[model samples]
Target: MKTTRKILLSAGSVLVLLLTFYLVWANTGLGSETKQSLKIDATASYGDSSNKGNVVGIQAFVEPVDYASEANFRRKIRFYMEEAKKKNWLIPNKSIVVFPEYFGTWLVALQEKERIYSTPEIEEGMQTMVLRNAGRFLATFLKCPQDVQDKLKYSVFAMKAEVIARVYQDTFASLAKEYKVTIVGGSVLLPDPVVENGLLKTRGGLLYNTSVVFETDGTINPQLIKKAFPTADELGFICPVKPEAIPVFNTGAGKMGVLICADAWFSEAYQTLKSKSADFVITPSYSNGYGYWQQPWSGYSGSKTPEKAKADVGKISLGEAWVKYAMATRAKEEAGIKKGINVFLQGKLWNLGADGSTIVLSDSAHATPFVGKSALINLWL
Candidate 1:
């Protein structure tokens, strides 16, 4: 009888622990830490335009947040941006706002409510879901015909596709509308990104790291350009696919082109934009480690350095290397871009230590150029 009691007690304890974990997993909130986001730093050089046509790089600091719904992400952004106007931050007619790459990419995790936010570690949270959905994950990514795993994966992402895309679009579109500025919505991982009739939609197969542009009216502009080159870590999760043809956006602010994350590392991209006579470039990037910005240049990101630039990554700091090769060497000199902005997200998401501070490279002399670590950088068009 005593032995029987011991067995039951052990079973009960296990059940209790599982139940406790479940409760904690499914409902982790941002907690009591409600404070206005720190400005961190701000710099402006060679852009003292008071009248109009300003491009702003928002180096936002995101928290370990799990959204109950997609709108919550927008709410958070709105709250953080309240500090902008009071500081006399420049927002004028025909302005452009650039966010960081993959800033909206994590919204897909919200599909699994459990531990989406409550998991103490981002890797743990993503892994937990990945374990449960292993078969489907493989199936969708693999895209094998008549394969149960592939079909299941496709169905899952397809069902959640609209939500993931919507959360991304709404978050940035809303901001653009509120500020009355054309906004680059950053990059999101979607199975298929199709912008039809000014609404974003997705189809399931393999994911692509895609960035979209939104006009001031909170509607998406129909320019679907995929990342031409992806970082090593992004390989398994997404595939690199370029658009059928390069398309430059003719926004009122300026003739703008976007290079999402590592896409900016290629000269071909710059050449394509230059062919279209792109007036300004917005490069949205996310460096995985916090100190990578200060690390020595480890050769080209993916492409060969231009022979004309004669760049030696080994001899230069990573930042200088970026100014040289990443944006296609002497961006102002080669691309004919007198003004540009590079924005990076500054937050700890999952395992990614967001680094690579924002920079606004300009050929303007009288206007001070952004050189150091500044969370926000603005340029006049």
Candidate 2:
């Protein structure tokens, strides 16, 4: 009887171990190959027929992220590129393409369980992810700054930093090379990211909103474009840099400056770009909450409203304020930046919805906002 009981106990232990391994594998494994057929939901273009100098802005309409695999997220981006080619906006070595802000930031959810996309709150989803990957998260959490107020965000970002950097870099670089156009790879929240010999390397620290420029040949520019302003939503987790000169990328089309969303609100950012002799500027932006643009203006969400921008508050809607106070009106008048495009990320992700239309500025004149589901706004330089 004792020997029989020992054999049964040993068998039960083995079965329990196998069950644990299977659960881990099911949650962590990248699922089967998935493909999506996407088409351009909306399209708008400005300037003359000459495609010599084309600046294409993809107002990508994204969905609840299912980074069950990297290719799942990448397919959406690939569809935009394919659609751009059909529209003839993609010119070899002669055009630059811009995507909306935070396009790459959601990559942190990559390889997470399917339930992460269905959670009512992002915090809940993140907590679930951390629990499932407790060992990995704990390893990174220990290395994080204990002094930071939001340890969850800091630790999560630290744990996923390397994967986020690698996937973000590889996705944009390959797209840039394949499309043969300069790409302003949208911003990603990373902890002290540095490009070493054209490779992205992250040294864990305070997370900064960073963007990278990929040349036509898929090589990354060594200079990192860090966002100097962080909105109220980002204050607790994201580190904002001191006001400094914005970086400009020399492309085949022209010397272009980039401002990530709220960065375009300040005059100093535009002035800094002007001093560098930028031919045009691109603002990759994202406005959260559905119909949030129609609501009353909330003043500057980042820092105190500049003296020049004080009068516009309360008088205009949030959407109008964006045009009046942001790049469309201010870029040209303040910094002689006559040509630029303000592109916003559209579509919904979990409970966080997106708004904002595409604003194209050319030859000192801006277009009426193109409020479409998903859009392509092109300006011929």
Candidate 3:
């Protein structure tokens, strides 16, 4: 009896050990599989020549609003993410880039507001005596450091940059965490604060117009160009950065090229991407409706009439610029078509072939409303 009991105990112990080993091995293998399947290598290239495989691009138009509201912004983003998740064409393993309109305005605004409220104006306003302070009210309420007040005046600009950064971070982080997709070429406005020279004591000095790039790893990439395009030594507009100047970074799954709205209008920018052997160019833009100049207006006689209009409305195309740029890029792949300098918006997605042939995978010309809501274009290569 004693020998039989010992034998049974030993066999039970060995069985328990085997079961533990199997569980550990299975869990470890499961982790490895998840990492391999879920993580995308965005830095992979399609070679130096014209793209050989399928390429996909998405243009998302974030609506324009006079003021920045975080709740509204978040809702809009959540809707887009849900839509992307639902789309059948969006591949879980493939790369995706989203172009958001006017991203810089929101970022700059948020920063400026934070700076302004940090001043002493809040305390001064609270301490005011209503009856006795009538004369001093304006002075006390308006009292701010001359330099500080000047800075506050442009707080709107600063808030724009801050909101943009927050939105990009939140949107990209959520989508990456939840959907496992990557966003490329997210936009931010860089402020150039005007600095007063110590000796000169002037009000305005340093101002900045910069577009920021966001990577998939929840970090912002360096500025593509310090000053994308400096204007009048005080303003910077969207301009093409040299391909060689762009620093190469892992985009998580596949290599991506970043471009702002105006940058897309320039051929040199596309050439730059081609030189870098980029697989896709992600473009973000803020475009107003096309026929602004031809919009109907009230006449001096107070009559609502088409005769009062300066130009024919139907003849003007608001989205012509985008169309032109798209066509030029497509034409580059055509055998006999000469390259044209004009920018076209040939709708959303175009697949460029090495044999100089092109296919329009998706076009949103008729589908997207002209009211500035966001739109998406997805294509498979």
Candidate 1's TM-score reads 0.78
Q: Write the per-residue lDDT of candidate 3 for residues 1-381, one digit (tens) a residue.
A: 999999999999999998777555433311011111111111111212222222333333332221124544445455555655554433443445453434434432221122222223432312321212233334433442333333432333332333354555565555544544555434444333221221101122232334444343444444343233322212222222343454323454445555544444344555665666655444444433333312442221111223423353344343432443332343233211222211112111112100111112122221223322234444433
> Which stretches of candidate 2 lie above 4 Å from their native place?
1-37, 364-372
- How much is 27 displaced in model 1, in angstroms? 8.6
Highest lDDT model number: 2
Quality of model 1 by C-alpha lDDT: 0.66
* CA-only RMSD, every prediction: 5.9, 3.5, 22.3
**Between which residue pairs do clashes occur in model 2?**
none
C-alpha TM-score for every candidate: 0.78, 0.90, 0.48
TM-score of 2: 0.90
What ranges in model 1 sit over 4 Å off? 1-40, 43-46, 50-52, 66-71, 88-93, 111-120, 131-160, 302-311, 364-374
Instruction: Report lDDT (CA) for all predictions.
Output: 0.66, 0.82, 0.36
Clashing pairs in 1: 25-115, 45-368, 45-369, 46-367, 46-368, 139-149, 139-150
Worst 10 residues of 2 by lDDT: 29-38
